[model samples]
Target: MFSYLVETGHTVEGAVKSLERKLADMKLQLLWKYDVTTKLFEQGIRLDQDYWILEVSHPDLTKKMLVQNQWSGFFLPCKMVVFSDRETGKTQVGILRPTSAFSHLEDPVLRDLASRLEEQLISVLNEIEQQQVV
Candidate 1:
Protein backbone atom coordinates (compact mmCIF):
# COMPACT_ATOMS: atom_id res chain seq x y z
CA MET A 1 0.00 0.00 0.00
CA PHE A 2 1.02 3.59 -0.45
CA SER A 3 0.39 4.22 3.23
CA TYR A 4 0.69 2.41 6.53
CA LEU A 5 -2.35 2.57 8.80
CA VAL A 6 -3.15 0.93 12.10
CA GLU A 7 -6.05 1.06 14.52
CA THR A 8 -5.33 2.17 18.05
CA GLY A 9 -7.30 1.34 21.18
CA HIS A 10 -7.26 4.96 22.34
CA THR A 11 -9.39 7.99 21.69
CA VAL A 12 -8.10 10.56 19.25
CA GLU A 13 -6.57 12.69 21.99
CA GLY A 14 -4.99 9.75 23.73
CA ALA A 15 -3.66 8.45 20.45
CA VAL A 16 -2.09 11.79 19.61
CA LYS A 17 -0.36 11.96 22.97
CA SER A 18 0.97 8.46 22.50
CA LEU A 19 2.13 9.35 19.02
CA GLU A 20 4.05 12.39 20.30
CA ARG A 21 5.83 10.24 22.82
CA LYS A 22 6.66 7.60 20.26
CA LEU A 23 8.01 10.20 17.84
CA ALA A 24 10.25 11.56 20.57
CA ASP A 25 11.56 8.07 21.33
CA MET A 26 12.42 7.66 17.67
CA LYS A 27 14.34 10.96 17.65
CA LEU A 28 11.84 12.64 15.37
CA GLN A 29 10.49 16.09 16.16
CA LEU A 30 6.90 17.05 15.88
CA LEU A 31 7.28 20.33 14.04
CA TRP A 32 3.61 21.24 13.59
CA LYS A 33 0.12 19.93 14.13
CA TYR A 34 -3.00 20.90 12.21
CA ASP A 35 -6.38 20.30 13.74
CA VAL A 36 -8.47 19.65 10.69
CA THR A 37 -11.74 19.39 12.56
CA THR A 38 -11.32 22.71 14.31
CA LYS A 39 -10.11 24.43 11.14
CA LEU A 40 -13.23 23.28 9.32
CA PHE A 41 -15.47 24.36 12.18
CA GLU A 42 -13.95 27.82 12.11
CA GLN A 43 -14.77 28.04 8.42
CA GLY A 44 -18.38 27.05 9.22
CA ILE A 45 -17.93 23.59 7.82
CA ARG A 46 -18.78 20.90 10.29
CA LEU A 47 -16.45 17.96 10.39
CA ASP A 48 -17.86 15.80 13.14
CA GLN A 49 -14.88 13.53 13.36
CA ASP A 50 -11.70 14.58 15.15
CA TYR A 51 -8.73 14.68 12.83
CA TRP A 52 -5.15 15.93 13.22
CA ILE A 53 -2.20 16.07 10.87
CA LEU A 54 1.26 15.98 12.42
CA GLU A 55 4.35 17.18 10.60
CA VAL A 56 7.44 15.33 11.89
CA SER A 57 11.08 15.37 10.93
CA HIS A 58 14.56 14.30 11.90
CA PRO A 59 16.85 17.30 11.31
CA ASP A 60 19.86 15.22 10.33
CA LEU A 61 17.89 12.99 8.00
CA THR A 62 16.14 15.92 6.39
CA LYS A 63 19.44 17.67 5.78
CA LYS A 64 20.91 14.55 4.23
CA MET A 65 17.91 14.07 1.97
CA LEU A 66 17.98 17.65 0.76
CA VAL A 67 21.70 17.49 0.11
CA GLN A 68 21.29 14.34 -1.96
CA ASN A 69 18.46 15.74 -4.07
CA GLN A 70 17.08 19.20 -3.54
CA TRP A 71 13.81 18.00 -5.01
CA SER A 72 13.42 15.70 -2.03
CA GLY A 73 12.80 18.78 0.09
CA PHE A 74 9.26 18.69 -1.18
CA PHE A 75 8.76 15.52 0.82
CA LEU A 76 10.70 16.61 3.86
CA PRO A 77 9.01 16.99 7.24
CA CYS A 78 6.89 13.91 6.67
CA LYS A 79 3.28 13.83 7.75
CA MET A 80 1.29 11.44 9.92
CA VAL A 81 -2.38 11.66 10.75
CA VAL A 82 -4.52 10.75 13.73
CA PHE A 83 -8.24 10.57 13.20
CA SER A 84 -11.54 9.11 14.30
CA ASP A 85 -12.47 6.34 11.93
CA ARG A 86 -15.99 7.18 10.76
CA GLU A 87 -17.36 3.69 10.36
CA THR A 88 -15.69 2.10 13.35
CA GLY A 89 -15.77 5.05 15.71
CA LYS A 90 -12.19 4.15 16.61
CA THR A 91 -8.93 6.04 16.39
CA GLN A 92 -6.48 5.44 13.55
CA VAL A 93 -2.92 6.55 12.96
CA GLY A 94 -1.17 6.46 9.61
CA ILE A 95 1.63 7.75 7.41
CA LEU A 96 2.24 7.92 3.70
CA ARG A 97 4.95 5.39 2.93
CA PRO A 98 8.13 7.37 2.28
CA THR A 99 9.48 4.74 -0.10
CA SER A 100 6.30 4.94 -2.15
CA ALA A 101 6.23 8.72 -2.03
CA PHE A 102 9.79 8.92 -3.36
CA SER A 103 9.48 6.05 -5.79
CA HIS A 104 9.43 8.25 -8.86
CA LEU A 105 12.79 9.81 -8.09
CA GLU A 106 14.92 6.91 -9.39
CA ASP A 107 17.72 7.59 -6.90
CA PRO A 108 18.82 4.40 -5.13
CA VAL A 109 20.34 6.26 -2.21
CA LEU A 110 17.19 8.24 -1.57
CA ARG A 111 15.16 5.08 -1.90
CA ASP A 112 17.27 3.31 0.73
CA LEU A 113 16.98 6.26 3.07
CA ALA A 114 13.23 6.36 2.65
CA SER A 115 12.97 2.63 3.34
CA ARG A 116 14.85 3.01 6.61
CA LEU A 117 12.75 6.03 7.57
CA GLU A 118 9.58 4.17 6.75
CA GLU A 119 10.63 1.32 9.01
CA GLN A 120 11.19 3.68 11.92
CA LEU A 121 7.79 5.30 11.42
CA ILE A 122 6.04 1.98 11.15
CA SER A 123 7.62 0.99 14.43
CA VAL A 124 6.10 4.07 16.03
CA LEU A 125 2.67 3.28 14.69
CA ASN A 126 2.91 -0.31 15.82
CA GLU A 127 3.94 0.77 19.31
CA ILE A 128 0.95 3.07 19.48
CA GLU A 129 -1.33 0.28 18.40
CA GLN A 130 -0.09 -1.90 21.23
CA GLN A 131 -0.67 0.71 23.93
CA GLN A 132 -3.82 0.93 25.97
CA VAL A 133 -5.77 4.15 26.48
CA VAL A 134 -4.60 5.73 29.73
Candidate 2:
Protein backbone atom coordinates (compact mmCIF):
# COMPACT_ATOMS: atom_id res chain seq x y z
CA MET A 1 0.00 0.00 0.00
CA PHE A 2 1.23 3.49 -0.75
CA SER A 3 0.54 6.51 1.44
CA TYR A 4 1.20 10.22 1.76
CA LEU A 5 0.59 12.99 4.26
CA VAL A 6 -1.02 16.20 3.11
CA GLU A 7 -1.28 19.01 5.60
CA THR A 8 -3.61 21.98 5.53
CA GLY A 9 -4.08 24.66 8.15
CA HIS A 10 -7.80 24.45 7.52
CA THR A 11 -10.11 22.42 9.71
CA VAL A 12 -9.27 18.75 9.26
CA GLU A 13 -12.85 17.86 9.98
CA GLY A 14 -14.14 20.11 7.23
CA ALA A 15 -11.69 18.72 4.74
CA VAL A 16 -12.68 15.18 5.62
CA LYS A 17 -16.32 16.07 5.26
CA SER A 18 -15.74 17.49 1.83
CA LEU A 19 -13.83 14.41 0.72
CA GLU A 20 -16.03 11.73 2.25
CA ARG A 21 -18.48 11.35 -0.56
CA LYS A 22 -15.89 11.67 -3.27
CA LEU A 23 -13.75 8.99 -1.73
CA ALA A 24 -16.75 6.77 -1.37
CA ASP A 25 -17.68 7.37 -4.97
CA MET A 26 -14.17 6.32 -5.93
CA LYS A 27 -14.67 3.20 -3.84
CA LEU A 28 -12.34 4.48 -1.18
CA GLN A 29 -12.90 4.32 2.55
CA LEU A 30 -11.97 7.16 4.84
CA LEU A 31 -10.92 6.72 8.45
CA TRP A 32 -10.45 9.70 10.70
CA LYS A 33 -8.35 9.79 13.82
CA TYR A 34 -8.20 12.89 15.95
CA ASP A 35 -6.36 13.41 19.20
CA VAL A 36 -7.98 16.37 20.86
CA THR A 37 -5.38 16.40 23.59
CA THR A 38 -2.64 16.80 21.04
CA LYS A 39 -4.90 18.83 18.71
CA LEU A 40 -3.95 16.59 15.82
CA PHE A 41 -6.12 15.24 13.06
CA GLU A 42 -5.17 12.53 10.62
CA GLN A 43 -7.58 11.24 8.07
CA GLY A 44 -6.77 8.31 5.84
CA ILE A 45 -8.38 7.60 2.53
CA ARG A 46 -8.06 4.01 1.43
CA LEU A 47 -8.47 3.25 -2.23
CA ASP A 48 -7.78 0.01 -4.06
CA GLN A 49 -5.78 -1.31 -1.16
CA ASP A 50 -3.69 1.82 -0.71
CA TYR A 51 -3.70 4.65 1.79
CA TRP A 52 -3.57 8.37 1.12
CA ILE A 53 -3.37 10.32 4.33
CA LEU A 54 -4.36 13.96 4.54
CA GLU A 55 -3.41 16.00 7.60
CA VAL A 56 -4.95 19.39 7.89
CA SER A 57 -5.96 22.01 10.38
CA HIS A 58 -9.42 24.44 9.59
CA PRO A 59 -10.69 24.27 5.95
CA ASP A 60 -8.26 25.98 3.61
CA LEU A 61 -9.94 27.07 0.41
CA THR A 62 -6.74 26.70 -1.56
CA LYS A 63 -6.16 23.12 -0.51
CA LYS A 64 -9.75 22.40 -1.36
CA MET A 65 -9.15 23.85 -4.80
CA LEU A 66 -6.21 21.54 -5.38
CA VAL A 67 -8.29 18.55 -4.42
CA GLN A 68 -11.11 19.76 -6.61
CA ASN A 69 -8.60 20.21 -9.41
CA GLN A 70 -7.88 16.52 -9.06
CA TRP A 71 -4.25 16.99 -9.98
CA SER A 72 -2.77 13.65 -10.99
CA GLY A 73 0.62 14.98 -9.91
CA PHE A 74 -0.64 14.52 -6.39
CA PHE A 75 -1.30 10.83 -6.75
CA LEU A 76 1.21 9.17 -9.05
CA PRO A 77 3.64 6.22 -8.72
CA CYS A 78 3.81 6.22 -4.93
CA LYS A 79 2.09 7.62 -1.89
CA MET A 80 2.68 11.22 -0.80
CA VAL A 81 1.80 13.78 1.85
CA VAL A 82 1.56 17.51 1.43
CA PHE A 83 1.68 20.30 3.99
CA SER A 84 -0.18 23.08 2.28
CA ASP A 85 -0.03 26.74 3.28
CA ARG A 86 -3.22 28.35 2.12
CA GLU A 87 -2.07 31.81 3.23
CA THR A 88 0.79 31.75 0.78
CA GLY A 89 -1.45 29.96 -1.68
CA LYS A 90 1.45 27.61 -2.35
CA THR A 91 1.42 23.84 -2.11
CA GLN A 92 4.16 21.33 -1.42
CA VAL A 93 3.05 17.77 -1.97
CA GLY A 94 5.54 14.90 -1.53
CA ILE A 95 5.88 11.14 -1.60
CA LEU A 96 6.03 9.52 1.80
CA ARG A 97 5.46 5.82 1.31
CA PRO A 98 7.61 3.97 3.80
CA THR A 99 9.26 0.71 2.73
CA SER A 100 6.78 -1.18 4.83
CA ALA A 101 3.92 0.48 3.01
CA PHE A 102 4.95 -1.20 -0.23
CA SER A 103 4.70 -4.73 1.06
CA HIS A 104 1.26 -5.12 -0.47
CA LEU A 105 1.95 -3.19 -3.68
CA GLU A 106 3.80 -5.05 -6.40
CA ASP A 107 5.41 -3.63 -9.53
CA PRO A 108 2.28 -4.08 -11.63
CA VAL A 109 0.18 -2.40 -9.00
CA LEU A 110 2.61 0.49 -8.87
CA ARG A 111 2.48 0.89 -12.63
CA ASP A 112 -1.29 0.86 -12.65
CA LEU A 113 -1.42 3.45 -9.91
CA ALA A 114 1.06 5.68 -11.71
CA SER A 115 -0.74 5.36 -15.00
CA ARG A 116 -4.09 6.28 -13.50
CA LEU A 117 -2.54 9.21 -11.70
CA GLU A 118 -0.85 10.45 -14.85
CA GLU A 119 -4.03 10.35 -16.82
CA GLN A 120 -5.92 12.22 -14.14
CA LEU A 121 -3.18 14.84 -13.84
CA ILE A 122 -3.12 15.37 -17.59
CA SER A 123 -6.82 16.05 -17.52
CA VAL A 124 -6.44 18.54 -14.70
CA LEU A 125 -3.57 20.38 -16.34
CA ASN A 126 -5.47 20.50 -19.59
CA GLU A 127 -8.42 22.03 -17.86
CA ILE A 128 -6.18 24.57 -16.18
CA GLU A 129 -4.48 25.40 -19.44
CA GLN A 130 -7.82 25.84 -21.12
CA GLN A 131 -8.98 28.10 -18.31
CA GLN A 132 -5.89 30.20 -18.68
CA VAL A 133 -6.43 30.48 -22.43
CA VAL A 134 -9.99 31.58 -21.84
Candidate 3:
Protein backbone atom coordinates (compact mmCIF):
# COMPACT_ATOMS: atom_id res chain seq x y z
CA MET A 1 0.00 0.00 0.00
CA PHE A 2 1.16 3.48 -0.73
CA SER A 3 2.21 5.48 2.31
CA TYR A 4 0.16 8.42 3.58
CA LEU A 5 3.12 10.79 4.03
CA VAL A 6 2.93 14.44 4.98
CA GLU A 7 5.64 17.05 5.02
CA THR A 8 5.70 18.77 8.40
CA GLY A 9 7.45 22.01 9.30
CA HIS A 10 7.97 21.01 12.93
CA THR A 11 11.08 19.30 14.14
CA VAL A 12 10.71 15.52 14.42
CA GLU A 13 10.16 15.67 18.16
CA GLY A 14 7.66 18.50 17.89
CA ALA A 15 5.67 16.64 15.28
CA VAL A 16 5.31 13.54 17.43
CA LYS A 17 4.37 15.55 20.49
CA SER A 18 1.73 17.47 18.57
CA LEU A 19 0.24 14.28 17.25
CA GLU A 20 0.18 12.76 20.74
CA ARG A 21 -1.54 15.81 22.18
CA LYS A 22 -4.19 15.71 19.49
CA LEU A 23 -4.72 11.99 19.94
CA ALA A 24 -5.23 12.51 23.66
CA ASP A 25 -7.85 15.15 22.93
CA MET A 26 -9.63 12.59 20.77
CA LYS A 27 -9.61 10.15 23.72
CA LEU A 28 -7.32 7.68 22.01
CA GLN A 29 -4.91 5.92 24.31
CA LEU A 30 -1.34 5.71 23.19
CA LEU A 31 -0.27 2.08 23.46
CA TRP A 32 3.42 2.23 22.64
CA LYS A 33 6.27 4.50 21.74
CA TYR A 34 9.32 3.32 19.87
CA ASP A 35 12.36 5.45 19.26
CA VAL A 36 14.13 3.50 16.56
CA THR A 37 17.43 5.27 16.29
CA THR A 38 17.55 6.03 19.98
CA LYS A 39 17.22 2.36 20.83
CA LEU A 40 19.96 1.49 18.41
CA PHE A 41 22.17 4.20 19.80
CA GLU A 42 21.67 2.75 23.26
CA GLN A 43 22.86 -0.62 21.97
CA GLY A 44 25.98 0.88 20.43
CA ILE A 45 24.51 0.62 16.96
CA ARG A 46 24.74 3.86 15.06
CA LEU A 47 21.79 4.79 12.92
CA ASP A 48 22.84 8.36 12.09
CA GLN A 49 19.17 9.27 11.97
CA ASP A 50 16.06 9.82 14.06
CA TYR A 51 12.86 7.82 13.87
CA TRP A 52 9.88 7.18 16.11
CA ILE A 53 6.70 5.16 16.03
CA LEU A 54 3.55 5.68 18.02
CA GLU A 55 0.74 3.17 18.44
CA VAL A 56 -2.74 3.94 19.75
CA SER A 57 -5.56 1.59 20.60
CA HIS A 58 -9.23 1.98 21.30
CA PRO A 59 -10.38 -0.70 23.75
CA ASP A 60 -13.93 -1.18 22.44
CA LEU A 61 -12.92 -1.29 18.79
CA THR A 62 -10.15 -3.75 19.54
CA LYS A 63 -12.48 -6.16 21.30
CA LYS A 64 -15.02 -6.02 18.49
CA MET A 65 -12.34 -6.72 15.94
CA LEU A 66 -11.11 -9.72 17.92
CA VAL A 67 -14.61 -11.22 17.92
CA GLN A 68 -14.86 -10.80 14.18
CA ASN A 69 -11.41 -11.93 13.02
CA GLN A 70 -8.31 -12.68 14.98
CA TRP A 71 -6.22 -11.55 12.03
CA SER A 72 -7.42 -8.04 12.60
CA GLY A 73 -5.13 -8.01 15.60
CA PHE A 74 -2.30 -7.18 13.24
CA PHE A 75 -3.89 -3.88 12.41
CA LEU A 76 -5.33 -3.15 15.81
CA PRO A 77 -4.19 0.02 17.54
CA CYS A 78 -3.50 2.54 14.81
CA LYS A 79 0.11 3.53 14.22
CA MET A 80 1.95 6.61 12.99
CA VAL A 81 5.60 7.32 12.36
CA VAL A 82 7.75 10.42 12.54
CA PHE A 83 11.18 10.70 11.01
CA SER A 84 13.60 13.56 10.65
CA ASP A 85 15.57 15.02 7.80
CA ARG A 86 18.63 16.23 9.67
CA GLU A 87 19.92 18.32 6.83
CA THR A 88 16.78 20.42 6.73
CA GLY A 89 15.48 20.01 10.26
CA LYS A 90 12.09 19.02 8.86
CA THR A 91 9.94 16.07 9.78
CA GLN A 92 7.83 13.66 7.78
CA VAL A 93 4.74 12.01 9.22
CA GLY A 94 2.98 8.97 7.87
CA ILE A 95 0.81 5.98 8.60
CA LEU A 96 -0.29 2.76 7.04
CA ARG A 97 -3.93 3.69 6.56
CA PRO A 98 -6.48 1.37 8.18
CA THR A 99 -8.65 1.38 5.04
CA SER A 100 -5.79 -0.29 3.23
CA ALA A 101 -5.90 -3.11 5.75
CA PHE A 102 -9.43 -3.95 4.60
CA SER A 103 -8.10 -5.14 1.27
CA HIS A 104 -8.93 -8.82 1.90
CA LEU A 105 -10.91 -8.67 5.13
CA GLU A 106 -14.28 -8.82 3.28
CA ASP A 107 -16.31 -7.29 6.06
CA PRO A 108 -18.38 -4.17 5.61
CA VAL A 109 -18.36 -3.47 9.32
CA LEU A 110 -14.60 -3.57 9.51
CA ARG A 111 -14.39 -1.49 6.38
CA ASP A 112 -16.58 1.09 8.06
CA LEU A 113 -14.33 1.07 11.10
CA ALA A 114 -11.26 1.51 8.95
CA SER A 115 -12.93 4.35 7.10
CA ARG A 116 -13.64 6.10 10.39
CA LEU A 117 -10.06 5.59 11.52
CA GLU A 118 -8.82 6.94 8.22
CA GLU A 119 -10.82 10.08 8.83
CA GLN A 120 -9.55 10.46 12.37
CA LEU A 121 -5.94 9.92 11.35
CA ILE A 122 -6.30 12.51 8.66
CA SER A 123 -7.88 14.80 11.19
CA VAL A 124 -4.93 14.37 13.51
CA LEU A 125 -2.43 15.03 10.78
CA ASN A 126 -4.33 18.11 9.70
CA GLU A 127 -3.86 19.75 13.08
CA ILE A 128 -0.09 19.87 12.67
CA GLU A 129 1.69 22.40 10.54
CA GLN A 130 4.59 21.82 8.19
CA GLN A 131 6.49 24.99 9.07
CA GLN A 132 8.81 26.59 6.59
CA VAL A 133 12.30 26.35 7.99
CA VAL A 134 14.52 29.35 7.40
* Candidate 1 TM-score over all chains jointly: 0.97
Best by TM-score: 1
Candidate 3 wrong stretches, greater than 4 Å: 86-89, 130-134
Query: Sorted on TM-score, highest at the top, how do the candidates line up?
Result: 1, 3, 2
Q: Tens-digit lDDT track for model 1 on 41-90?
A: 99999998999999988888788888989999878788899999999999
TM per model?
0.97, 0.32, 0.86
TM-score of predicted structure 3: 0.86
Better of 1 and 2 by TM-score: 1
Error of 2 at 11 (Å): 4.9
Stretches > 4 Å off in candidate 2: 1-12, 32-109, 117-134
| Candidate 1 stretches greater than 4 Å from native | none
What is each predicted model's overall lDDT from 0 to 1? 0.91, 0.35, 0.78
Ranking by lDDT: 1, 3, 2
The Cα error of candidate 3 at residue 134, in Å, is 13
Cα deviation at 12, candidate 1, in Å, is 0.6
**Preferred candidate (lDDT higher): 1 or 2:** 1
